[model samples]
Target: MLHKGEAINIAPNVVHWHGASHDSRFTHIAINPNVSQGGAVIWGQPVTDDEYNASRS
Candidate 1:
């Protein structure tokens, strides 16, 4: 997860994801430029149940 003042730049044709610890919190801000004619930030698919379960530490 992103911390305070942290940022992620998802470039074109790029697929990325992040998450927090199972017992912690996760938070982030996504910005798209295409959506505003600059570029697009598309949130593709949701994390599958198996993916989340695998991420637990």
Candidate 2:
């Protein structure tokens, strides 16, 4: 489990996504060092709650 002030490393091409609680405020600082090397972010459609829960099992 992640605690406050902890961090993790994620490499390229991973299926990871980010989110926040419905009533909470949050922020993120993203740096794309790969931008100059022809790297681009891959975008996908947002998954519905039903789809997310189904994947959990």
Candidate 3:
């Protein structure tokens, strides 16, 4: 897990999901660069209960 002052870079076309923890509050910055195709970001579906619970393990 990423602690305070740490950062992670998500490359283009990569699939990733993140959000606030159930027991803590935090903030983060996500920057997606515009590619030659003119697309910068592609959002996916919301996180389901099963998905979130499984990830916590």
Taking all chains together, the TM-score of candidate 2 against the true structure is: 0.54
In model 3, the worst 10-residue window by lDDT is 31-40
| Backbone clash numbers for all candidates listed | 3, 0, 0
Ranked by lDDT, the better of candidates 2 and 3 is 3
Query: Which ranges of candidate 2 are over 4 A from the true structure?
Result: 47-57
Stretches off by above 4 angstroms in model 1 are 1-3
Better of 1 and 2 by lDDT: 1
Q: Per-residue CA lDDT of candidate 2, range 1-57, in tens?
A: 456676676688786777554444345455668987876677678968876566446
Local distance difference test scores for all models: 0.68, 0.65, 0.75
Report residue 20 deviation for candidate 3 (angstroms).
1.3
Question: Whole-model lDDT, candidate 1?
Answer: 0.68
Query: TM-score, each model?
Result: 0.54, 0.54, 0.64
lDDT of 3 by residue, 1-57 (tens): 878898888877788887866666668687655656676677889877876677468
Candidate 2 residue-wise lDDT at 47: 68
Q: Which digits, one per residue and each the tens of the lDDT, describe model 1 over residues 1-57?
A: 356777777668787777764566777666664676756665668877777777574
**Which number leads on lDDT?**
3
